[model samples]
Target: MNQESRRALIRKLVASRGECSVEQLAVELGVSGMTVRRDLQALCEDGRLIRTHGGATLGERATFEFAFLDRVNKNQEAKTAIARAAVRLASDARSVMLDGSTTTLAVARQLRGRSGLTVITTSLPAAAQLQHEPGIDVLLPGGYIRSASPDLTGSLAETNLELLRAEIAFLGADAVDDRGNVFTNPPDNSAVLLKMAASAQRVYVVADHTKLGKPALRRFGQLTQWAGLITDEACDPDFVDQLQQLGIGVIVAPFE
Candidate 1:
């Protein structure tokens, strides 16, 4: 594709997907990663897009840091194991909050047949998945849906969250360290996570092993604040020990 064509395609992708990765663009446009990076740079120069670690986003919109959905799709087996463990943590007649991360969505998938529970969340996909369950009540919070992540945020979501409290909140983090630091990419999205974090009795971060060491721009909280860390078997025993040392419970999913 030509320069103008690549630019148009990038804008179209940003509008449709809310973010587009260099790899994705290259595949779509039949170009190299370097060419796509140059294309993204030009778009950034024109003030039409904002570039990130893996991709570029539409300018002027709130871009919640996210990886390509395909990346999430790549870890199905691990997520299934993690989800099974997360469901084990749930108790009876409880209120729970699930965030937008795919890991949290896995938890939502597992909670499907559970008898009586109120699941309050900002994830549209999670809400859709749970709304039809016979004995469970699914509640959605009001908010601006961030398209890339499909998560609710802003004052509207916060207002709904403020009115309710949860026994357990299954949270998702873009990044966590051995030190137990929670991080999000954009500061605005970080506020949404913080609000969700504060309204729960036990804050459980449900992450796959891939998220443990990668860093992001916005820092959310410290290690000790979390009730537990739930991850797949890929979690290194030594690293889990480090988090346990910080007084945060660690639940490693059973080996597949």
Candidate 2:
């Protein structure tokens, strides 16, 4: 494709998914990473998108429902770091709860093969990964699945959670505000998060630094509701201090 066509396609991809990485764009466009970066640069110059580390996203004014695969590819390194740290916190917990966010899915991946662990989750992806672990028991709360997210939601899911409690719950959020409020798009998604937190003895919100200091469509829980937070090193020091002030254990994982 020509320069104008490539640039246009890049913009379309970014706008549709909210974000697009240099590698993803390159592969999809059958071009080199350099070519993708150059197109992203042009898009940035035109004020069409914001260039992020290794990726480009629609500017602040651009809002779209975050697709699961889109999130899985964004800030992958940071998510892996946060997931590793979260797994350590659950090492001793006999029972755990996991949410459906892509970040929590990372944590679930790390929990595979954990012996004598009972995992209760609303995430279909998480359940699928842990179901085959010999020593791990995976339980799902059967309910209506959100086509876009593949997470179980609705009254059935909430009812199942009400009957059981977990030693710890690892959750994910779309954004977190300065006041420590966790936000997610669509009210039902936040509802499931709230139920999971309420059913756990302790809660840890696993999110990347990009989510910090931003609030999405709705607030599901306050920062005080969580016992700890697992985030990447890219998080702001001042924000970490704020969470610490609230008696929330702040664990910053290294991306490297």
CA error at residue 158 for candidate 2, angstroms: 0.6
Over 4 Å off, model 1 = 1-68
Candidate 1 structure quality by residue, lDDT tens digits, 16-73: 7988888988898899999889888887887778889889877763233224345457
**Candidate 1's error at 19, in angstroms?**
19
lDDT for each of the candidates? 0.80, 0.85
**True lDDT of residue 227, candidate 2:** 87
Q: Quote the RMSD, in angstroms, for model 2.
A: 9.7
Residue 180 displacement in candidate 2 (angstroms): 1.2
Off by over 4 Å in 2: 1-66
